[model samples]
Target: MSFSGWGYVWTAVMPLAVLLYYFFRKKYKDQHVASTMFWQELMKEIKASPYLKKLQHHILLYLQLAALLICVFALLGPHLTSEALEGNEFIFVVDTSATMLAGEPAAFELQQELMKEMATQTGGKPVTIVTTGANPEIVLRKEPNREALETAIDRLAVTYENAKIEQTILFAETLIDDESTVIHVFTDALDRSILANKAGMAYEIHGIDQPLQNVSMRQFGLAKTEDGIRAIVQLVNETAEPVSGKVILTDGEVEKTANIQLEAEEELLVPFEQLPDSPVWQAVLQVKDDYTADNSMAAFVQEASTRVAVDSSLHELVGAGFRSLNVEVDLMDPMQLRKAGGSPLVTNQTDLLAGQMPILLIGRNDEKTHRVAGAIETVPHALFTYAPFDGIYISEIYPPFEEYETIATIDGEPLIQLSPEGDIAVLTDIQLTDWPLHPSFPLFLWSAIGELSGTDNFFGFFQPNEQRAVALASTRGEWEIYKDGEFFYSYIEGQGAFSAPQEPGIYEVVGEGKTLKMIVQLSNEEKTLVQGTSYRIGQAEETAETAELSIVPWLLFAVVFLLLVEWEVYRRGNAHR
Candidate 1:
């Protein structure tokens, strides 16, 4: 509503003069019509007065007058004043982190609306856009054209990655020059980023201070049950009061629901019984909160069979323990296991290595006969998971005879050793320690089987940002990790490892006539929704909200379009005459 050239208002009077001339100008008289028959020929012979035409209810005069007024208005340009034109150069750090996806429009979604409003108010000013995804990116940098800017903004998407706002700010700092350039961040909070000691731009955090009520699905999995599979899910309520909701389990074909009630800040484990048969499973909470990204999750399940050959001599103890568990075990001839291929060999002697697949040599001698007095020192290994044997006694032990890796030791002697392929040999009978009777006995055996049997598919899931060794289903062929059915990375079957994707979702890998499904999910760290106070980096200054937006050019275009219409109307009217 403001004008840049108000002092030139006196010039608009020039168009009014033309309007006055059209209304009061003298008119031309018609020649005396001697005969009515000759009047038609006389109209074609005599030219109409160009300067003094009859103006009684004439359309041309009105059209001319309107065109003159438009010229006057175009001279006085007009445009709406908006708050976005505050800076000559702007750098926007928009947080697209998982926490922003909490409300009806999502904090990030509202942030996008705010950004669009700023763009509309840009008045053609340059803007640089930054997104805080897993990897900070400069979506649009110093863009001045409004159409192109809008296109870039439209392409922006919500990311399930953790907040990389600090990194994004670092990237944005490079775009800023002086104290006048403003950096506005739109996110759930300002302090959620690692901004305590980082040095950079003098930015203000424009975030939603209201804490969104969120119930998060921290983790979930499926365990074998007597009747069927049981779905185990860990949930937490981030609100100030107790929340009541249901957890739905689905396999794309069938569905089941389990209701949950949790107090504020309370963590609970809920299990759903009797799962249906499905390769793919999804767990979704029924809680309706501001944040819903963590409300639902997907997982894939794969099962494997384990076969072990236990010598007839130790069959009374070791063989009985294996049968007591659900896994398969054989007490027959060792040759049958060797020819069967891929099955592990469990014997009291190391010479059983003739088979070459994978071996677990359990010492045959009883520990009670040759008791060793020294306490053993064991290193951390997957076999020790849930199995604590720190003070267990070992009497007779066959120290590692080869250069294979030693897994554990007693005083200065090696107690157990293993090869890269999980060919392990316990120098003493496992029954010698309290581990067999311990609850971790089954877990220990399962761990050994998973490694030695080369289980094709992973049994569980991983957090998006977590890194661990991923075992391939087979060692004979190369394996490739894929995202959305396209190749992303490749891994050697022998090495059997690749970094997990940093975005929360499901992924798959294929090789050796088998496919493996894996789930990479967001960590617990991203579920926090508290906002942070605004701070600065280099120097602080006030923000601007107005810029020069003139509509004179657009107005002139309208004037030209109107004039074209006037010309067309006059031409058609004269032709009819």
Candidate 2:
């Protein structure tokens, strides 16, 4: 037994004071009796039952003492030690992924309630909370305050990204030490085998395993048409029953609706033709479903307005690539330009127009030829999105330039390089490389034109919580980002990167006098709400102080009962007298 507040032990003096008062209280004075015969009879009766008279005289004193003692015990805050409270350190791993929002009340909402209940019962034990999303975050660490724990649990929210549950669990395990810790995982889809394999860990999985029905837009794209543009949308029914709904495509001004029906687990492609040109278009799925994160998607379209002046020997190929993207191309002869003293925007003749315009230099200074030796390494950049350097044979290349950033390299030789001024320099001679024969050649030229002309006609699409470095045409000042027409975040010029919002919507980046639209959508994994399994691992070792059962209420109840008995005895004694 333990007492929380020992200061209340001084209250034990109350019972002693009551005993002293009973022994030294003022004595009653003898009064002259008018009826001597009745007095004499009462005295004879008292002598006949002396033991009963003594018991009646001391009963009130005993009752008063008992009540005082019990009150003191109650104030001391006594508690019984139990084995159930051994592992007082608790770790809560919460999954904040989008799938937790699939159910009616939402698995996340239920998890919050459960956490609050368990936390309240911890009796001021230390608790840690970890939330999982695109990245795992420790929100609360070893906090013993009940109010702080409740506040942290209430503040938890669901992210639209997929949860990294396995990683988060491993991270939580790192916090365990010599102390016995109990870990509770709250998630929507955790595999039972994961916990079962954790042999010596004391943990429990609280998972929500309900059948979820959902319909999602698998993909959305736009294609250039003779009149305007066409919208291609693919929809999927993720349920076991047939589903039908209307798909509404809108550009904030014009709205087009299409009704469609699908069998269970079916995918259908629906195209809308002759739609007027718009900067952005959105598609909304109007199906009754558990998961709504994937029901809506947005697409951004930008018309090509970049004009390229090509003077390279491969102008025919380059011009063909530019024209295909609806970009105007002006082809110029190298000899005619040299004779007329005309500067070329793009050329293999580096001496003709050096440092004059944003140029795409093909084989500028090839003084020496080096054969490819080992594996080729390419840096991640916007230029290599569709144009990878795989299977491209390079026999000769110019020496690496210190002023340019190398994009692709063979062994130690630079193959593709880009300057800070947006000039793309291909060190390898195109005649000696077979990259031009590949289908990615035109795509490479398209990227090059966009980079040189400082025009970004490409649309940016990303999954929720995804972050990437953004390359804008003007990299000069702070860029402001807006989501759904509201300001979201901002970043500086050189450090131009931003993370997608937790919700699915369209984001606009405004900077350097230009605006670009980016779309954040739900990934396929988030859309498919898989049922999870729950498991309990090893048990917590029993300890003497594992739990505490407070006896204050019981003690106080005894005090109340004793006081009532003392009051009744005093009232009866007075009435008899």
* Top-lDDT candidate index: 2
TM-score, structure 2 vs. true: 0.64
lDDT for each candidate structure: 0.69, 0.76
lDDT of 2: 0.76
Error of 2 at 479 (Å): 1.4
lDDT of 2 by residue, 1-577 (tens): 9889898788888888866666556566685766989889878986898556655768876787777777788888889865543365889999998888887999999899989877756767788999987568999999988789989999999887888788889999998863578899999877776666787768888888777888888888876679888998999887899998899999989999999999999999999999989868999989889888788888766433367777747636667766786777777777654443212266776664354566778776446666666666887666775566777777777776688889788987788887776678888666777777887787787777656654454346778888765444333556677876889877664453457777888777777676777778888777676877676777766433546668887888888888888889899989998
Off by over 4 Å in 1: 5-55, 76-86, 192-201, 222-231, 250-257, 272-281, 298-454, 459-507, 510-513, 531-545
Say what the RMSD of model 1 is.
13.1
Off by over 4 Å in 2: 1-13, 19-71, 79-88, 193-197, 302-360, 365-459, 473-476, 494-497, 541-546, 549-577
Residue 444's C-alpha lDDT in candidate 1?
A: 59
Checking candidate 2 for backbone clashes, the offending pairs are 85-546, 85-547, 86-546
What are the RMSD figures for all models against the true structure? 13.1, 11.6
